[model samples]
Target chain A: MKENKCCCSKKQKKLKVVNIGLQTFAESLRAQGVTVAQVNWRPPRKLDSEMKNILDDLL
Target chain B: MPVKKVTVQQNRYADSVTLMGILDAVKKSGKVMLAEVQMGTPQNVEVMRKLGFDIPATVNANDLVIALEAQTNELLDEAYKDVIDRLDRKHTDGEETFNSIDEVDPADGWNLCQISLPGEYAAEEAKKAINKGLDVFIFSDNVSIDEELQLKRLGDEKDVLVMGPDCGVGMLDGVALATMSLVREGPVGIVGASGSGAQEVACIVEKAGSGISALIGTGGRDLYPQIGGLSMIKGIKRLCEDDQTKVIVLVSKLADRAVMDKVLTFADGVKKPVVAIFLGADESLFASHKVHGTFSLEGAALKALELCGISCKDFEISDEKIKGIVDSYMKKFSPQQKYLRGVYCGGTFAEESLIYLKEHNPDSQLYFNMATKYARKLDSHLKSQCHTLVDLGSEEFTIDAPHPVFDPELRLKRFRQEAQDPETAVILLDFITAPGVHEDPISPFAKACAEAIKARGGALAVIASICGSVNDPQDIVKCGKELVDAGVILTGSNHQSTLLASAFMKALDNRK
Candidate 1:
C-alpha cells in the first residue's frame, strides 16, 4: 500500500492511503484537519488498530 | 439511344416492413423517389394522417426518389413529432407513461432535457430553462463556449445543474439516461473529457458485470489549461465522499500534467486504484503510482475492469486485428507523403492524431493550444496553411456554425483545401453517427468527401473513424466503403486510424 496526502483542492488537507484499512486513512486525514470517509467493501484489522491508536493519542 | 436522369418527387410512408423488405421494394422499383416511414404509435399515426401526408402501408422506390428532391425539413419534423408522441404513449417495464416535465418531480433525480434545438435557440432556450431551476441535459453539438461558460456559471451560482454543451452518455442516481447508456453500475465512478470515451468506459464496466456509480462528463472543456478541470475536480471530490463509490476513473484526450498531479495526489490516498487514461499523452509520468495509464480509450476500459477484478466480456477490437491493419496500411503507403492534417469533430481524435504524428516524427511541430491567448504558441506556419488541427468545438470554428458533426459544410470546405495542399499527405477525421445523430448525415457527407477526393486527385489520403452501434454497422461501412472507392482509406476506431496512419508514415521512411 502507498500513502499520500490529499492535494486536490486548497481547502483540503488530509493524508490518505489506499489498500489499507479505511479507518487508518480516515484517522490520518482527520488528524490533519480534513474530513474523512471510506466507500469500499473491506477494512483490514491491523490498519483499523492503528487508526484506533491514533484516535487515542489525539484524545 | 441516350437516357437523361430525371428527378421525381415521391413521398412514401410505410408503417411496417423489415429492412430487407424495404430494400427489395426499392431495388425492384428502381432509383428512389422518396421514402418516409412513420414508425409511430397508433395515436401518432392518427396525428400524422391529420398532418396531410399520405400514410402508405409500404414505401415504394418512386416515393423515395421524390423525397431525395423534396424539402427534407418538413418530412423530418413530422418524423420527430411522430417518435415523441409514440414515446409519450408507450409503456416500458410495465410502468405507466408520464408525459411532460410537470408529471415528474425535478428534485427527485436529474431533470434531463436533451436540447437538439437549432442554431442559437438551443443555447438560448437551455439558458432560459436552466435559469428556471431545471437540470439541463445537453446533447446538441456546436454550442458556443461563451454560452456554455455562462450556463455553467449560472449552474454553479443557482444550484441548478447543467450536464453538457456537447456531453453524451451519463448515469444519474443509479438511473442510466442520456447518450451511450450502455454500462451497468459498479463501485467505479468516472470523469471524462470526451463523451464517447466516457460511454466506452461505462460499457466496459458493464461488460465486466459491474455498474458505474457516477459518470461525469467534463465535455472537451475541462482539461484545456484555461478550464483547468474545475467542474471535474468538483465532481471527483463529491464522488470520493459518496459511500457507494469505490474506484474512480479519469479519462481525457489531454491534461496538463501539473494539474493532473494535484488530482492524482488526492486519489493516491483514497484506498482504491485510480485508473487514469489521458489518450494522447505519454504515460511515463504516472509510472510510480498504482495508476494504470492507457493509450487507447478502449484499452483503458479493459484495464480498469481488470484491476477492479470484474469479469469483462471482450468488446474492444482484438490486438491481432489492430496490428494487422497497421502493418498492411504501412506496406501500401508511400513515405514521402508524411505530414498529417486533421479536421475533426471530436477534440480527442485530433489530439490522438497529433500524438501519432509527433511519435513518428519527433521533429514535427504541433500548433495546438486549448487557450486562445496561448493560441500563438501554435506553429504559425502550419496554422496559416490550415494544416493545424481544427477542432470544430472551438469558438473560432463554431462562430458561423456549430460543428462539423452537426454542420459538416465548413469543415468539409477546409478539408478540401487542406487535401489539395502539396505539404499535406494525410488527413484524419471523425465521422460520428449514433441513434440520436442528425437525420440523414451519411449520404451528404459521403458525397462531399467524394468530391474532395476527386478534386485532390487522391493526393491526400483520409482515415475516417466512427462511433456507432455494432447492431447497425452498415451506415459507417457504407460511408467508409464509398470513401475507399473514391481513393481514401477509412477505419472504424480512433486507435486503429491513428496506428494505421503512424505505421504508414513509418513504413514510407523505411522505403526511403
Candidate 2:
C-alpha cells in the first residue's frame, strides 16, 4: 500500500476495494473511481464445487 | 472507378467479438481500401448485394462485390474460429477466483471490502475483512442484531468504519457505494437509514444545482433498540468530522425513542447544521434536539439544500399548471375511463407516487402488492383495489425473469393490460436510466401506450417521470422525448409526476 495519511486522526487506509458479492456493488465502486476487484462468490455447495472443477478444467 | 462493400456472415451466429475481429482483419488488410466489414444475417447480405447495383454503372461494382464477398467469407471463417478458441481457453471461474478476503490484499490490493454475502455468512465475512483492516460496506439483508453488533464492534476495534448488513445506498468521496444516484461532489453530506430515502435526497440535491460531499446509507433497522443506530451514529460523526462536509442530513422512518434521543444529543454536539427526516415523526421531535426535521423524502432533500444556502422549489406543483393538464386530459377520457393505474419500474418510485397522491388527496385509495416494504405491517397484498400501484421490481414480478429495469417486456405487458382496461383513464409510469439498464426502454412502452390509447379511442392519459441524468448511458433525453412524442406527459421529477397523477385522479374522482 502506498503511504497516504488518514483523513482524520482516525485510521490509516488505502483506497483499493474487495467487493465480495453482487456485481452491481462492484460496478458502483468502479463508477465512483475506486480500484475494486469483485470476488465471484457462490454458496459452498456440491453443484458449485462440480461447476468450479469443470470451470477449472476448462482452463 | 470501383465500388467497394464487404459484407460478412458466419454460417452460425457470429457474436459481437467475432464480428469486431472480421472488421479489424479487413481494416488491417490494406487490399480492401475504405472497406466496411458488416456482420449481419444472410438476409442483410442479400440486401447488401441488391444495394450493390445502385453504385452507378460508371463504377465496376460487380468486380468489387465479387472480390469483397470472397474476402469476407475467408475473414468470417478465421474470425469465428479465433473467437471460439479464445472463449474456449478462458475460464470465468479462474478469472474470478478468490475464496477469502485475506487472499485479496497483497494480491489484488483493496483496502475497503463491500460484503454482500447471505446474512448467515455476512458477520463472519465482515469479521475477516475487518481483521484484515479494511473498511466494510455490507449490503446483506436478514443479518441478526447480535451479528451486526458483533461485526460493527470488531470494525471499531480495527479503527475502520462498518456501514451495514442491510445498507443499500452510500456515497463516499463522490463514489456511490451501493444503491445511489450519480451525485456530484459538493458540500452536503448525508447519513440515511433508508436506501430509497437517501437516493431521493442525493438525486434531488444533485438536481438543485448543489451536490453531495457524501451519502452514507445506514441499514433500514439500524435505528432499532436492538441494533442501536450504530451505523447512523458513526455516519453522522464521520460526516461531521470530514472537512468537505458543510452540512449533515439524517433520514430514517423508524427511530426508537431512546435511539432518537441519543442521536439528537449527539447531533447537538456537532458544529455543522443537520437536517433530519423522521417520516412519521413530528418536527417538534427535533425542537430541542439541535436539528431541523422534515417529514417526506422530498422535504428532507429540500430542507438539507436550504441549510447550505440553496432553495429547491420545484417539488411544489402550481394549481394552474395542474388544472390545465387535468382539464385537457379530462376532455378526451370517456365515461368508462375513470380509474388510474400506475406501473412503476422501481420500488421507491412506486412508494413515492403513492405517498404523494395519498397526502394530496386523502380519498384516493391505492392498492399495492403485498411484497412491498412500504407496509411492514403486511397487507394480504395478494390483490389490488381500485386505484392501484404496482412496483414492477418487486420479487413477485421479478421471480422468473429479470427486473423490468433491464427487461421492460414484463412491465410493457402489464402496461398493456392496464391500458386496455376500460376504467384506466390514466396510466402512470416511471422510466429509470442507469448503466446496465435497457437502452431503448421507453420506445417499447411508448408503442404499447400508443396502441392502448388507440384501442381506447385515444383517451388514456400516460403520465411518466424519467429517473436519470444525461450522464447515464441510457440516453434519457432521447428516450424521454420518445415517451413524450408518444403522447406521454413526461414530468421533470418524480414528485411533479406524482402531483400531476394525483391531481388528474382527484379531478376525475370529483366528477364521479
- For all candidates, state DockQ relative to the true structure: 0.01, 0.23
Clashing pairs in 2: A16-B110, A16-B111, B370-B381
TM-score of chain B of 1: 0.57
**lDDT of candidate 2 over B1-512, digit per residue (tens):** 43443422222222233335555765464444343333343543455556552232322211112114224545544544543454333224243445566676644455667887657667878888888777788888878888888887776666667888788767665566654556666778888887766766776777677778877777777788887777777788778777778888898875798888788788888889988877657556877887887766667778887888887676556778888999988999877777788888877667777766766677665677754333322254333457888887888778877889778998888888788777888988987765545767878988887777777776888898776655566666787778878888887667777788888888888888
Compared with the true structure, the alpha-carbon lDDT of candidate 2 equals 0.68
Interface CA root-mean-square deviation for model 2: 10.3
Q: lDDT tens string, model 1, B1-512?
A: 21112122233222122222443443344333333333333543454455444445443332321111123455444433443343222223242223223333334332334443332445765665566555555655577777777777776665544666666655544433344443444677887767877765665565445667777776666555555565566557656765566677887766677767666666666766678878766766677556667777656766777776765545545557656755654444444454566677766666666666666655444445344321223443225332356676566667668566656677777776676666666677776654334434456656766776666555556777665433222355565566677666666467667776665455444445
Candidate 2's DockQ: 0.23
lDDT of each: 0.53, 0.68
**lDDT of model 1 at position B117:** 32
TM value for model 2: 0.73
Instruction: Output the number of the lDDT-best candidate.
Output: 2
